[model samples]
Target: MIGFVVEAECMFYQDKPIHFECTACGKCCTGNAETHYIALTPTEAAKLRKHLEVSEAWFRRRYVEHLTRDSWGIRMHNGQCAFLDKHGRCGIYALRPTQCRTYPFWPELMDDEAHWQAEKKYCEGINRGQVVDIKVIERKLKQQAAAEEHA
Candidate 1:
């Protein structure tokens, strides 16, 4: 099988740089194509509950889908997230789940080469973007994961 390889430079904190300009194509939002929902931390779940102004039980019943072990992936109905708006923008953009906020840059899930290739095939943004420093991306992903854990 032909695999996809990601190439980028390494840099320190001050010099690390990366940029992505979303075209608003909504390709990432289409179906469950390129996205895999990350399990929400307890704090994250509580925050989302408050942000959506719903009870924690209701939020869990409606929006949270159980994955392996104690993990959960956000549930989607009819090919879109429950929180995805008509304009292709996240309804809870400001307080969206950590998984939604970290797109094209998943930390714990990107280690599999086969999965990465599958993602590259489905996401147009991945192939067209300018070169980014991998070390920078790694750092940002780590930070995001840490924030989610603490949220």
Candidate 2:
């Protein structure tokens, strides 16, 4: 019998640097009905609520949904992030979840150049502006994993 296997190139191990700089075009913040949701940690929720000067109960009622007993995601309305403004900016930019903070450079996207190329279609910041070192990218990945662990 024959079997097929696919191995993705590891950008982290290969240490290929990539350039990125947010243009604030807000494409990443918007999604269609089929694919728009942002998971949030308890820490992220608290931070957002504090920024908005709202109570925890109010925050949950307005912006959060329980994905599972241990997982929570931001609400999506009208096929986009609930916190996205009409001006194409994040309404809660300062307190956006780690997932949002780490864009284009998400571990999965960074796994291979092909993934990064595909992502460039949506994110203008990809392969542009400052050349981010692989070490910085690795640190961001660890931070994302840590954030997910805590959440």
**Cα-based lDDT at residue 42, candidate 2:** 84
lDDT of all predictions, in order shown?
A: 0.60, 0.77
lDDT (tens digit, per residue) of candidate 1 on 56-144: 78999998877756676667767777777788777776776565566666543355444544676556665456756666566656656
TM-score of 1: 0.63
Across 2-83, the per-residue lDDT of candidate 2 in tens digits comes to: 1101222335435566888999998887787456678898878888898999888998999998877998899888767889
Worst 10 residues of 1 by lDDT: 1-10
Which residue pairs in candidate 1 have backbone atoms (N, alpha carbon, C) closer than 3 angstroms, thus clashing?
none
Flag clash pairs in model 2.
none
For model 1, the superposed segments whose C-alpha errors exceed 4 Å read 1-19, 30-38, 107-118, 133-135, 144-151
Compute the lDDT of residue 145 as modeled in candidate 1: 58
- Residue 37, model 1: Cα distance from true site in angstroms: 3.4
Q: Score candidate 2 by TM-score against the native.
A: 0.84
What is candidate 1's local distance difference test score? 0.60
